[model samples]
Target: MGDTGMPRAFIPRPSPCAPPSPISVFATIDSPPWTLAMSTYGYENCVAGTFYGFTKTEFNPGDTFSLQWGAIDDGATPLNITLGRAGGYIIDEIIVGAQFTKTSALYQLVVDDTANCTLEEFSWAIPDDFNTTDPQYQIGLFNASVLLGADGVPLFGWQAWNPDFYVRPVSSTTTTDASSTTSTVAATATGGNTTTTTSATSLSTFSASPTSSSVSDDSTSNSETIGIGVGVGVGVAALAAVLLGAFYLRRRRKKAQTPSQGLGGVRQQYIQELPATEKRPPMHELAG
Candidate 1:
């Protein structure tokens, strides 16, 4: 061991490279099915050639690049960018911001997480322009499978379905009022008294009177006719009774007179026939 604590060997410090600047991708969703706005921030870095097992590869500039939210086999169009490629490359440095812009499409999105599950999975589609007035630019992602990164991990956490816009009334109110009024004219005899009340309001008006006299008259011609009919019925019944009594009396007189008359005639005939025999057949006279 050299002299205790004799200034340790001077180790030259390594120079630090500048950290990569964060990139931002702004996205706004104006469509019906989705309404989302976000800014994705990230950094770009070049991978080592040895990592790809290719020693002769060269980086190419001015080539096309794309960053998709879903897996390569998901059948979704990748969010793309046009760039130049220089030479051969494995993983090129295409700086992507941490934030991204997104918006909804016209058609609604319905995502199901589990088969037959009532809970619905939520998703949003992105449009090219945020200020586009035409609704056609809206991109709709319906029942889309969750997006996955190269590492096979979900890009975003779980999200619930929600509407983008809201509606409100211009004005509203609630109030009510009702009232009424009354007028009366009265001419009364010596101790008569009368009173009236009236009220008026925006909704309605009312009026009342303590006393009122209004009569309707109907003629009694029908009653007079009915009385005449009753009188005629009584007269007819009396006439029928008198006629029946006369007939009964005549019949009784005829029956009683006939008996007496018949008896008288028979007696007369018998006396006329028995006169001679009666003179000779006087028994007491003959025996004397």
Candidate 2:
């Protein structure tokens, strides 16, 4: 073993159940030295004949990126590079000595592990704290198994896909605090989020609240008109009823006067026809 406490890899014998092996008892365990590199937007420093992969260069808070790695060979175990198992690190994208992973965690994207198969691939999404200005995030080969050399350093064997690249953040333009009168629509929304616009035509925005207000005004005007029409109709009906009542009373009075006058005239005519002698009547019977 090297000075480090880690143990070096060695060849293993065949199965005990098999017949006596004809091959030599001793063999050389040929392996390479440990290597570490970084990747960033439009840049990567990968060791020859190693397993590492990455899919995208830019992303937003919740966007996803694809990743892949090569499988470990037989009779070898992957080195656990993370000081904390299941944890890892990333290099700076824009500034030296700066940590890109300081803003967010690099998650492993894998489906199966029953067999640490080679040529595996997976995906991961950019975390909420992922920086947008310098968007590239680099990570070591996930799910890749490495052999520990005598120096206790991890060494890669083969790779399946590209290991490093840049992921650009999605750009957008939004508006907030937009208020407009009922006359004209404006280019703003309630949630304070707005779409990117180049010209006035592109920002032809509308507001439901303002439209509803106008509709309410029209409804009030219509209600007033309806109320006036009802009042006029009621007044006309009342006048017509009054005139009809007056005409009916006058006709009844005229009919009653006509009958009385006719009776008086007939009585006068009969008296005149009687002559003066007939008028004396039995008054000749005198004072008896």
Candidate 3:
């Protein structure tokens, strides 16, 4: 396919062991198709600051892949290839030729004859953290001269404005124990009498993962419910019995508190003792 605009310029790192460019992480996305075009030697139709022949876009963590440069026409000289976050490199800063070949102590790649070259594959052990948060990755092709501290060298690498590939998002279900253990050594000595005390506290805090409920769990729950219900019923029955006993005792006490009727009364007792036919004499007859 024709070039989809020009690739961006990439600045060479100061040192060989320089870190990949600091890139803000983004969610994983599907990769786009490769659009690098290349030509043969002498009349090499190669463009400056642009990588030519890489195809695959997305890769799984720890997978290996090959990076292709169409044709350099620079035979037997080593090249510098780097992978990092894209959109931040300058292309014109990389200089190629015999003087720049294999200048750095670091090794990027070796090409015996660029004109009759075969693309060699490279493997990147993608780290565990290269997931949903940070997916963008890119590669660059450069000459070893980019590493030297020349007085007036303004060359850059051939790279793209966007990332070349991505790492697929991995589900984060199996996170490791986030807690670290620490040991504090203690010693107590009293005239050669020594003791060691270990008061280590371990705290394991993680989300309570849901587990499949078994029959025993259901049975325990049901048993607890049944026991509570039976206890409440027994408590209510005991309360009722206590209230009935109190009511009966109160009635007996009330009856005992009442005075005896007519037995302790003198007129009523005399009238009851006299016969029913007996009558009292008149006052005049009594006087005569």
- Report the number of the highest-TM-score candidate: 3
Which stretches of candidate 1 lie above 4 Å from their native place? Answer: 1-219, 275-288
Each model's backbone clash number: 40, 10, 13
As a TM-score, model 2 comes out at: 0.29
Q: Looking at candidate 2, what is the lDDT of residue 88?
A: 22
| Ranking, TM-score, top scorer first | 3, 2, 1
Over 1-288, each residue of candidate 2 has an lDDT whose tens digit, in order, gives 223222223323234354321221112112221111122223233232244544344345665544434323321322121111111222311111111121112212222333333332223445556555644434442122223231344222212224444544444411221223411343352333343333333445444557879999999999999999999999999999999999999999999999989999999999999877544535355474
Better of 1 and 2 by TM-score: 2
Which of 1 and 3 is ahead in TM-score? 3
TM-score of each: 0.24, 0.29, 0.40
Off by over 4 Å in 3: 1-12, 15-56, 74-77, 86-117, 147-155, 159-163, 172-288
Candidate 1 lDDT over residue span 97-190, tens digit each: 1112232231121222332111111222222332223212111111112221212322121111111121112121111111111221222221
Q: RMSD in angstroms, all models? A: 29.0, 18.4, 17.4
Q: To one decimal, what is the Cα RMSD in angstroms of model 2 from the true structure?
A: 18.4
lDDT of 3 by residue, 114-198 (tens): 5444222223345455444666766655455335323333334332332367766544321221221122122222232333222
